[model samples]
Target chain A: MALIELRGVSKIYHLGGEEIRALDNVDLDINPGEFISIIGPSGSGKSTLMHILGCLDSPSKGSIKLDGMEIGSASARELARIRNQKIGFVFQFFNLLPKLNVLQNVELPMVYAGCSSRERRERAMDALRLVEMDNRAKHRPMQLSGGQQQRAAIARALVNSPKIVFADEPTGNLDSHTGETILKLFHDLSLKGSTIALVTHDPEIAAVTPRKIEIRDGKISKNVDAKLSGQHDGPKFAVGSQQN
Target chain B: MSLLNAILVGLREIWAHKFRSLLTMLGIILGVSSLIAMSAIVKGMEHGMKEAMIALGGLDKVLTREAPVPTWQSHLSDQARGRTMRDVEALQRSAPLIRMVSPEMALERVTISRGDKRTRPSEFVGVWPVVIEMNLHNLEHGRFFNDVDEANAHAVIVIGTAIRDDLFGSPEQLGREVIPIGERVQINGQTFTIVGMFEHYESDQDRKKREWAREHPDEAAQKQAVARGRPGYGGGGSRSGWAFDRKNRTVYCPMNTMWLRFRAASGTGNVPDPTLTDIDFKVEDLSQMEDALQQAKNVLLTTHNGIEDFSFSTQEGNIESVDQAIRNARMSGGIISAISLLVGGIGIMNIMLASITERVREIGIRKAIGATFLDVFTQILVEAVVIAIIGGLAGLVAANLLVRFLASLSPTGNTPIVTFEAMAMAFGFSVAIGVLAGLFPAFKAAKLNPIQALRYE
Candidate 1:
């Protein structure tokens, strides 16, 4: 069975008496250890789909399941629990809390997960180490470079040991070189059997992922499985080494 | 998240916006501090007024006398009768609440002399020994004449400190045989032994009156020199139709001794001159003062054959007026302080709303990180309460300091008392304001949609 399944999901918003369909009849499934990208231009409902999948929002109409639990039918408390235990999100602007240092920011999800402070500290440090941000753990978000901030955000996402990580334009604020470095980190994570759903408007960014779901006009227009194209980067990194 | 984490977050938000937080706290601080200040002031005023009332013989001292009827009206109505020793005895027997009746007859402008030392005639007050306590006078030396002295009409006197100094040398000569106890002094050609000396009791109002009189000696003496049969006594302007002249310079003797020795010089020279100038009735309990006064009045009326010649007056009436004024002041101060607190709560709410708006994105980020509505609500509410509490504490400290400073400057020796109850009340009110003021803003923040919040700038 797929780790996540979405069928006939739709989201409609009303603006000044006009009905705008942000997402229309989207059907999708994500397997464990998959590296996938949802690609679309601005206003293509890609961000809305990411919000629904991350459980930050519920579909206006849909049957959505995560880790065998229904997403759309879950209570707000349950959604929060799923978000804390089952999924992690990295946003476009490197959404690190400005007041907290890198280490405290990384420990946020674990804090929600009710992890003991000692365990949270150890796990957050390990996550920071995975993203090469451990040395800057004491620094606030604004003190770091755009790439460094995103690295800390990724550490925060991985701190909870979520089964699926969603990156919504994760490198949108970074230069190409930093963006490429972040993509390589995602690739390393995916190769190590950590499922990643990377959302981006850039086609080149989408091309690097093994699978792509291209969205247009609030609907999925094309789906591609490119496992063979990305085969050379697989099995190069140790699996579960960071987790253990 | 734990409560500590939420508190830490709230603290950080306040620290991040220092100026805005202080401005928001201004209302609570002002409210709570003023509450403390007002309480202290009112308490101090109450203490001062009570002291003043007690100094003026207090609510338990009632004076009764014949109602003044003009000579022309005296014939039309029953002749105005005087309050006498018989009437005093009658009230004592009839009024259960009347503890003691001190009848006073005065011998004014009589010469007092001992050996070569002599002073101008001061009024001599003849009363029972209980008048010492009833009039709140303290004996400086020896003892007041007791029942034996009154019943036997012994020619013994307790001179005021001023008269002691005049008849002898200065106060240091007191024990050195100058105006010594058991030594004789002459009042209106009659010799009396000095039995005691009373310490001067004067209030601030009395002191001010004395100061004014000293400043205008000629006018004061002229106004007071009238040989009116009853001298104006209690030194303040006549309010209750009588004045108790300063007791500091007068002589006190047994009523029988005064009447026997100085009756010719004291009253209208009529045989069987049974007129008593004033009667001092000490009620057993202050709570029953009105009833005691009424009962005494009935006794006097029936004894006088329903002539209604005597009128009753209590120092308690004066205390009531003072109490009413103090109560009004306290109520107004409380209302003003309450307004300040209310304004402070509103200010806190306004600031909290603004804080929520400014941190919409932050709220979104927290929400996305598995923070439920409860978490968000608690964080905002905690921030508001924290601000209010901090302000409240600051106000408490400020009010105490201000009260102490004001007390130090008071000339009347009125020290504002900051009771524990006042501090606790102010602090509790501040916290309540914080919670109440923070509620709506916290609710607004909690109700925010995570998606919409993240989208907000």
Candidate 2:
């Protein structure tokens, strides 16, 4: 069974008496331990799809299920609970709270998860260790380099061990070398059986994932699985690493 | 999120902007302190008024004053006879509600003199010995006029400390206390022996001042030296001080002595009137004051031939007026403090609004991490309440200092008392204001769309 399933999901907006559809009848499924990327340019509604899949928003008309529980009709509070327990998001800007240290920032998701402080501390340390950021736990985001901050943000995303993690332009704010390192980290995390989705406008970044879903004009233009097609090579991280 | 975590986050937010938080709390501090200080001042005023009321013969004492004949009884006005010993004797016999009566015959414009020193007394009334209890006088020395003095019309007088101070010399000046017993003084060419002296009457604040002065004699001497040539410096210049001063300047003599020497010698045609100048009495039960007054009125009506030319005045009217004045003062002070507190709440609200606006991105980040609307709301609300609670505590300290400063400004004025009730109430009010102030800002932050908030630059 898929970890997340979306059928006929739509998001409509009304601006000054004009109806604008940000998402139109999107059908998709994400299985456990799958590494996928949703690629599109600006204004292509890929962000909207990611928002809906991440439980940050509910669809206007759809049947959406996450981990076998229907959530499309859930209230805001229920959605927040689902988001806290079943999903995590990494933003392009490394959205770790500036006021908190890296450790505290990583502990934030579990803090909302209502975990005991002891448990939150232990789990946050484990997540930071997973991202090789345990040594920088006490450093604030502002004091860290771009790659370190992104690592910390990824630690925060994995702190709660959610069913799925969404990275929206995860390397958009970093240099090419730092971006390559972050993408390799994501590839490593996916190989370790974490279900991860990268949302980006760059095809090079999307090539790191085995499966790619391209969105255009509020519709899915292509959904490709390299493992099933046997026509595309595996993740090009080796080629990128050779260049590095 | 748990409440503890939310409060921790709120506290961190405040700590991040310490100067701004302090400025935001300034309004609450001023409000709470002013509220407490204003109540303290009103409390002081009430204390002074109550002290003055007690000095005016207490709450149960009633006076029977002569009034003009009513219009309906104008034809029988000639038959009207004023309050006299007849009415006093009648009330004692017929009015069971009347506890004790003191019929006074005042000799107006009286001056006592010994050697070259002389001073006019506030009241020089002739009375029976029962006048001591009727007037709440404390005879500190010698003895009151006995029945033998009243029967034989003895030329004896009992004076207050003020008259003693004037006739001989005050203890402060003579460096020794004078009893003045067995001393002779002349009143209008009539020689009278001083038989007793009442204690000096003063409010609590004045008593403390006097005792403090006595304890530090050198300081008292220096103060007197400085005030020697200043007009009204040593006098009872305050509004409520006169009550105590007037009580201390009284002179009393035997009622028959007054009738024989002063009243009997001066009348419309050289015939004694025999009418009493004042008739004052106390009731057995303060709760039954109305009934007691009615009974006394009935007894006096027959004594005055049903002329209705007299009226009874109870201290209750004076007490009501004093209470009304205190209520007015408290209301005005409360309103002013409440306004200041409201302004403080508005200040909190304004700052909270600005604070949430500054943290829009922060809110978005938290919300994206699975923080519910309730969590964000509680965090903001807790921050505001924390500011108020801290400000409330600081205000209490400020109020204490403010009250002390006020007391020092007028040392003789009633000392402002800070009650625990006032502090608690002010604190509760500030907290309530904080909650009210936090509501709009918290709602605005909680209702923000996470996507748009994340997009907010």
Judging by DockQ against the true structure, name the best candidate: 2
Residue range B129-225, candidate 2, lDDT tens digits:
8898898899999999998999999999999998998889999789898889999999987899999999888766677878899899899888878
Candidate 2's docking class is medium
Worst 10 residues of 2 chain A by lDDT: A235-244
Candidate 1's C-alpha runs over 4 A off are: A228-244, B59-126, B139-143, B146-148, B156-202, B206-251, B255-320
Model 2 CA deviation exceeding 4 Å by range: A15-19, A236-244, B64-124, B133-143, B146-153, B159-192, B196-251, B255-312
Cα shift from native, residue B69, model 1 (Å): 24
Worst 10 residues of 1 chain A by lDDT: A235-244
Best by TM-score: 2
Model 2, position A141: C-alpha lDDT score: 95
In order of listing, the candidates' clash counts read: 6, 0
**Residue pairs of candidate 1 with colliding backbone atoms:** B233-B243, B233-B244, B233-B245, B234-B243, B234-B244, B234-B245
Candidate 1 structure quality by residue, lDDT tens digits, B208-323: 66678769878877756653445444323435313234456768889988778767444455665667878988888888877888888789878776667767787766777888
Model 2, A1-244: lDDT tens digits are 9999999988998999998898889999999999999999999999999999998888999899999999999999998888888888999999889999999999999988899999999999999999999999999999999999999999999888899999999999998888888998998899899999999999999998889999998789999999898876766554355555
Over A126-215, each residue of candidate 1 has an lDDT whose tens digit, in order, gives 999999989998999989999999999999888888989999998788877778789889998887889999999998888778789999
